[model samples]
Target: MQSQHIVNAYDQELRKLHSYIAEMGGQAEQQLREAMQAIVTRDSDLAGKVVREDGLLDELERKVEAQTIRLLALRQPVACDLREVITALKAASNLERIGDFAANVAKRSLALQQMPEIGLTRSLGPLGQTAGEMLNAVVQAYLDDDVDGALRVRDRDEDLDRAYTALFRELLTYMMETPQRITACTHLLFAAKNLERIGDHATNIAEAVCFRIRGSLPEEERQKGDETSFAVVSPGILGDGPTR
Candidate 1:
């Protein structure tokens, strides 16, 4: 039947959209992992590679957007089909942002490498690793279409937020101890914050997966553990304090 043929064609297009999203998710994951490794090892070469690879994510996003537009125009998908298309569009946007954040961490790594060593960098390794782990789990959650898995990923964002807050306090202590460490600490601060944001974006993607599966947003308020904005920092004897 001609109608059956049309239905088959539309299904194929949906599959293509999902394939594109999966590919983009994989790339975003790799970028975060490499960026974190570059920061930990102070490997400028690896950082440069991450910077170069970001363009790939950008291109993939554009492709997803273009394909989604075409599907909307041609298929006029309804209900579940519409939700699948919308989720793909939203997931691509979040993944692209995550890629940008990873690139930022890489750039910060390059900058921090030129500065004097500070003790705070030790905390950064674990912080970045935790963010990467969150990303990996979210990507898997999306692929599995497992709503429970996605909810678990959303919950894990709190862990990264707590790690970031602790790192923020330690970095302030370093800056207060010696004015000479401000420059390096500042760069480390940016890198750690970027990693934290990456975790948030992964959570966003997880929420998208949930919405796609459940056809509604989660009924409960998403748990948030980030305290960077309200964390209190007393003035150091030298007149430097952390305010974020």
Candidate 2:
């Protein structure tokens, strides 16, 4: 029957879309890991490689978008089928952003190498590790279609946020204590922020996975722990009494 053949073709196309997403997710995670390693080791070559490799994720995202558009137009998918297409689109978008952020970290690492290494640079390793772990977990959750695993990833984002906030404060204090370190610290700050953003995009992917499987987003608002905006570091606290 023609109807049965068409349905089978549509299912195959959906599987292809999922394949694209999985590939993108894997590439993005590797990018983040390499970018962090590049920073820790102060290897400009590795950082440059990460920047150049970002194009692959960009191309993959384009492929996902094209595939989803074709499926939407030809199949007129609805219900669960519609969710599959939309979730793939969303996951691809998030993965692309994660790639962009990883590339940003790599770029910052290049800049950081030109300056004197600061003590705070060491702190980024742990932060980046947490983000990389989160990304890896969420991508796995998406591939497994495990709504519970995805939810766990979502809940874990707060830990990354809190870690970032703590690092931000430490960088601020370090900058105030030694003005000469400002330039290097600023680069590290941006690099840390990029890693933090990677965590956020990973969380976005987890939420998308939840929606795809459960048909609705989590009911309660996810808690946020990033408190950088309210953080203040008084220069007076660093040295002698308060300055007039």
Candidate 3:
């Protein structure tokens, strides 16, 4: 009876840990969504709300850390149970970063509001949407213990990277063509980069899911499609001043 009770108690602790991860994932997703909405609508008020709410994610991460530590010290979980606890730690860390990047997007939006509106801003919507979707999908994969789903999310990150690269080139072309719009374009560039980073963190979460299930990280090197560092945008490529 005592052994059964101890087993049940251990199971309960694991469930609580899982619940913390799920809650953190949901909060991170909502933060990214709201941050994107603030950018699309140029609502400083909404941006401010996102910034204010970031503290909640921080608190949740703290709880995850505390819980994991207690489990490791008291339960001494091994094998799959050990992997589960470690993966939760990694996922919480990645989710916290996602929340941070989302907050950064919100902060950039607030800056964008002070600058002249640019047509390039519209291009960011697709990038942000892709990142948000990846995050949501990866979170679901983690919760469902779907290794295939996690792999799919990992593969989809390249798509987000490609989209970000394309947008980066466009922003560069626009800035080169119109030096006067540099400030506004710079803000947009930062905001777009933040979204790109969120995609990366989502990918990290997907990898954590794989580790929990497979007991090893992906053997193959993860692919990367971001080429912004090597991208060269010539003013002559467009053959004219930027539209709008």
Order the candidate numbers by TM-score, best to worst.
3, 2, 1
Candidate 1 Cα outliers beyond 4 Å, as residue runs? 235-244
Clashes of 1: 0
| lDDT (tens digit, per residue) of candidate 3 on 1-244 | 9878777877777788888988998999899889989988899998999999999988999999898887776565679878888889889999999999999989988988988788788888899889988988998999899999999999999999999998888899888878999988998899999989998998998998999999988778978999898876787785564566
Clashes of 3: 0
For residues 102-186, could you state the per-residue lDDT of candidate 2 as single tens digits?
9999998898899887767778988888888888888889889998888888888899899999888778877877788788888
lDDT of each: 0.84, 0.86, 0.88
Count of steric clashes across candidates, in order: 0, 0, 0
Native-vs-model 2 lDDT?
Answer: 0.86
Q: Which 10 successive residues of model 2 have the least lDDT summed?
A: 235-244
Winning model by TM-score: 3
Q: C-alpha displacement of 131 in model 2, angstroms?
A: 1.0
Question: Could you tell which candidate, 1 or 2, scores higher by lDDT?
Answer: 2
Q: Write out the backbone clash pairs for model 3.
A: none
Q: Local error of candidate 1 at 115, Å?
A: 1.1
TM-score for predicted model 3 compared with the true structure = 0.95
**What are the C-alpha RMSDs, in order, of all predicted structures?**
3.4, 3.2, 1.5
At residue 187, candidate 2 shows an lDDT of 87
User: For model 3, what is the alpha-carbon lDDT of residue 230?
Assistant: 83
Ranking under lDDT, best-scoring first?
Answer: 3, 2, 1
